[model samples]
Structures are given as structure tokens and as C-alpha cells.
Target: MGGVYVLGGDWLPDAGNRKVLTELPPQLAEARVCGLMQTRRREWDGAVVRDVLSERDARLVLTIPLSTQERRDSLYWMAEKRGRFTVRSCYRELVGEYEGDGWMGWTKRLLANAEALRNRWVECSRICPLCDEEEETSVHVFFTCRVAQRCWAKVRVEFAGDVRQSIQTAFQYMFSVMDADRLGFALIVCWSLWQCRNGAVWRGEAVTED
Candidate 1:
């Protein structure tokens, strides 16, 4: 019952008496044929046909092309470049890739800055340059700093209750709720804050609310 299915040919049995055929009717099998049949049917009937065809399992069947020449079937690994599995491809398949766009670059820089401060790779005050209230860390500098809170307040974003302990969690929350424009504004604020921190530390400049 399961060989490569040909859409327009002997796919369906010619039984006019049956209301529901086990196999897809030839009229419903081909996209062109289905479109024509839909136009001839009532609007409700067409809608029902569309709904059935749109189901995940039914749509998968539609992707199989009718064979012209008989060729031996062979299995292939889709994750690999040339349908051949390799150690590198397997690793990549398991780990995946970083697909985040927009604010990710700035976020990474902010994280690096925090790490630099932690490792004492950069000679600056251990306290947050913006707040001067707590030890400078990724979470403290970006999320919990009193001065950072003020900047967020200006944007009217609430960062209270069960405080996020990591940069990943904070970014996830922001991205889920804020659209591109809002996310851009938030990133700009963070960048400006980082710049102000740099100026304060390097040039011994005074920090201002503005």
C-alpha cells in the first residue's frame, strides 16, 4: 500500500458510490486539480477541504513528488552539508547556533566589560561606576544598579519583583515583551550607560543624571 504515490494517475480508486475514499481523490491530490475542484464546490465545502489539507500529516504527503524513473531509495542525513554525517556536523547539530539579532552584540560587550572588571583585567574601581553602591558585576551593572534603575524608569519599564539573576534572563524578558523599537531604545540606554561608565573611570569625569 506504501510505494511512491503518483498524484494525477491511479492514486485513487474509481468508486463514485463512496462518500469518503480511503485514498485521496485525484482531484484533491494535485494542487491545480484541487484548485479547480474547490472553485466548483460550495464555499463551506472548499473551506473544509482546505482545513484538511492544511493539517501537518496531510501537508507532508503533498511534498512527495511523483516519480518518473524508478531509482533505489537511500537514506540521507539532512543536518550534514552533503547528506553525509561528519563529527563536525554532528557537533553543530547538537549545539545549534546563536540566531539572536539586534541588541545581542551590545549585550555581549556589556558582559565582557563585567567579566573584565571581575577578573581585574581592567584597572578601575570595583564598585559600579554608575551607582557606586555595589560590586560591579553583569547583573548588578545592567539590572540592579540604582542608576540603571533610574534609566529604566525613564523608559517606564518595571524591573522589580523576583529580580533576574543573569543577563540571559533579563534579555529574554525584554525581548518577549518589547517590540523592535522598544528593544532598540533599551539597548541604546545600556550603551550610553556603558559609555558614561567608561568616561567616569578613564577620564575621571563626573556622573550626571542627564
Candidate 2:
């Protein structure tokens, strides 16, 4: 409990050391996520949180006021029972995935990267069901999964952006540079990626078509 406190991330400012969070390895990322969950559990183990997430994000996370009901949200998402994306949760963060109004659908879809399942502490393969090669992180589902790669390939989008970055940052960079029309089209492809991922994971459907 050695940090500042706030409630929710709607008004939270950006991290000062975002590179640290982005550069952390997947295993350490899980640790950072667990540290955030300490807040939800009404236990702010500030040492572990700051040690893992660096000072800036830890302070940003600590700002959120704990609730008696144990709410579920993230300060910055890991692949599983981690914090939600705090710095950038809006679809506009992905460079205007929505125009006049924001995309509530896409915001919720942020938590559905594993085709509607997210592991907590259980030791299981985090492998992508569609690819069977990489972890089923949101980045993988949308940009780097084998099926996802094919979908991007169909549209002649060969680059998968940067898999090392969080899905939000990667999407922002990938979409923001495109023209308005391409950006709109990319949003559709993004939604298709989600739908096809669900179809393949939940319905036992083949998903090679773009």
C-alpha cells in the first residue's frame, strides 16, 4: 500500500515508462498482471507491483480505488487474468475504428482475444487454438495467428506490425497511418478476424478463407 490511489482509468494519464511494460517478457508480463490483481483482491502489494511494472504504471494502477464487490478490469492487459488496458481502451485508440460514436463492441472484444476464454492461474498451454504455435494473446488473434495472417495476406497486408507491442499500440500504429478508407476497411478485417477466431475455436469450423 505504498502508492497513490484513483478510481478507474477514464481520467488516468499515460504512463511515463511505457517502454518497460511493452518490453517485458511474457512470463514477467504475467507477473505484472498478477500484481494488478492484488488491487482487485483488496491487497495492494506495492512492492511487487512497482518492481514488476515499473514506477509509472504501478502508480497509475494504484490510482484506481478498490471496490468492495471485487470488480474485474485491467490497467494494462496481459493475455489472461491481468489488468484491462488502462492507457488506451477506446476503439479510437486504434485510430478511429469508430467515427462519430466509439465502438463499445470493439472495446468488449478486447477481452475476448482467446475466443471468449481467459485463463487465471491454471497451468495450461496458452497456445493459439487456430495456430497452435503462439500464445493466444490479443495481438496474436488479430495480427499474428496463422489464420489471421492469411486474412491479412488476402488483403495484401503482409506486415503483422509489431508483435512485441501490445495489441492496442500495434493496432494504433498499423491503422493510424492508413488513409481514411483503408482504416475503415482495416476495422472490418479486424472484426472478421475476431469472428473467424471464434468460429474456429468454438464451432469447429475451418478458417483459411480470407
Candidate 3:
């Protein structure tokens, strides 16, 4: 894929042109003739510059020293210190930065939201929004509810043992048996079911099977 050229600071929109920096603005173009355009911000003071460009982009720019010598531009990996690309480096680049505390954090959030912990604190109804026939416990919302069961039934995978246990155990068992792609599809179904439940509760919409 062709690499993207990101201009720093707030310049005028390039009208979809990537070479906007090469064709500098009239003010900057004139300044470039006087060597003033090459001036670095005093506030930066040898520190990394920040603004429109990302941290990676800023670091990449710094690596290219200002030189009078003209040379053919070449692309290099920005993730690695030596600008060499590797499978691991590419994988890390694709994944980007880690956010939250992974599955454990997600489980806690799911429990808190499904169990209506906030509602309990305020002395409100803890009824399941989708079914309205039982308390909105984590297990009911994620596994046992009529809507949740329908979502799970749509998946092609079969459970060897009982998956009616807690959410964590159920997921653990499911993950152990399924491949990565299958697990991902199952997770998407779970998320979609949750979204549908929220829609029913907040917007009075009917649960959709598809």
C-alpha cells in the first residue's frame, strides 16, 4: 500500500493532495527561500514536537535530518528503532496500543452493567430490560435470557458440556473448543445481543433476530 504523508501543524486543507508540504503555502514558501521556514519551534527545545501529527509521525520526521543533499526518498518501518520491518513489528503496528485491562476488565464492566449495580445503589428496578421477566443479572442478560439464548443458538458451534454456568466459565469453555475466527464471531454475536437489549430498554424497540 502507498504510505500516507501527514503534514504537521494546522495548515489549510490540501484538497486531497498529499504533496501539500512540498508545495508549501505562499508565506512558508517565501520563508523557505530565506532559510526561516526550516526554523524549529523554540517551545519544543529539542523535545518531540506535537500537534496534528501523531507521536510516531513526529519521531519519523525527526529521523530525517535537514540536508541540502537531494536523494531519492525511501520508505522504512516507523515502529522499529532501526527502521527495519519484521513480522512481530508489523503485528504490533496492526494491533496498536493496548487499552483497558483486557478480558478481566471487560468482564467486570459487563457484570456491573448487567447487574444494574448503579440502579441498586439508587433503589431502582433491577429487572432485565430485554425480557422484563427476571432480574438483570449477568448470567441472565448474557446467557439465560430468551433473547441471549436465541443469539447463541444462531452460532454453528456446539458445547460439549453445560455452558449455563457463570459468564467467565462459559467463555473459558467456549474459547477452549473453538478456533480464533469462531470465537471472534461468537463475541460479535454477544455484543450485538447486548446492543439489541439496550435498544429495547432505552428506545422501546423490538429485538431483531438477524
What's the TM-score of each model vs. the native?
0.44, 0.42, 0.45
Decoy 1 TM-score against native: 0.44
**lDDT: worst 10-residue window of model 3:** 10-19
Candidate 3: list runs displaced more than 4 Å: 1-105, 111-114, 118-120, 208-210
* Model 2 clashing residue pairs (backbone): 5-63, 6-63, 6-64, 6-65, 74-83, 74-84, 75-84
Off by over 4 Å in 1: 1-110, 120-124, 160-163
Listed per model in order, the count of residue pairs whose N, CA or C atoms clash below 3 Å is: 0, 7, 0
Q: Candidate order by TM-score, highest to lowest?
A: 3, 1, 2
Better by TM-score, candidate 3 or 1: 3
Residue 135, candidate 3: how far off, in angstroms? 1.9
Clashing pairs in 1: none
User: Which candidate comes out best when scored by TM-score?
Assistant: 3
lDDT of prediction 3: 0.52
- Per residue, candidate 2 scores C-alpha lDDT tens digits across 60-160 of 66665655664555344431235553223323443334544543445444554443355544454477767777888887777767777677777775444
Model 1 lDDT tens row, 78-110? 556466845334423322343576545445554
Candidate number that wins on TM-score, 1 or 2? 1
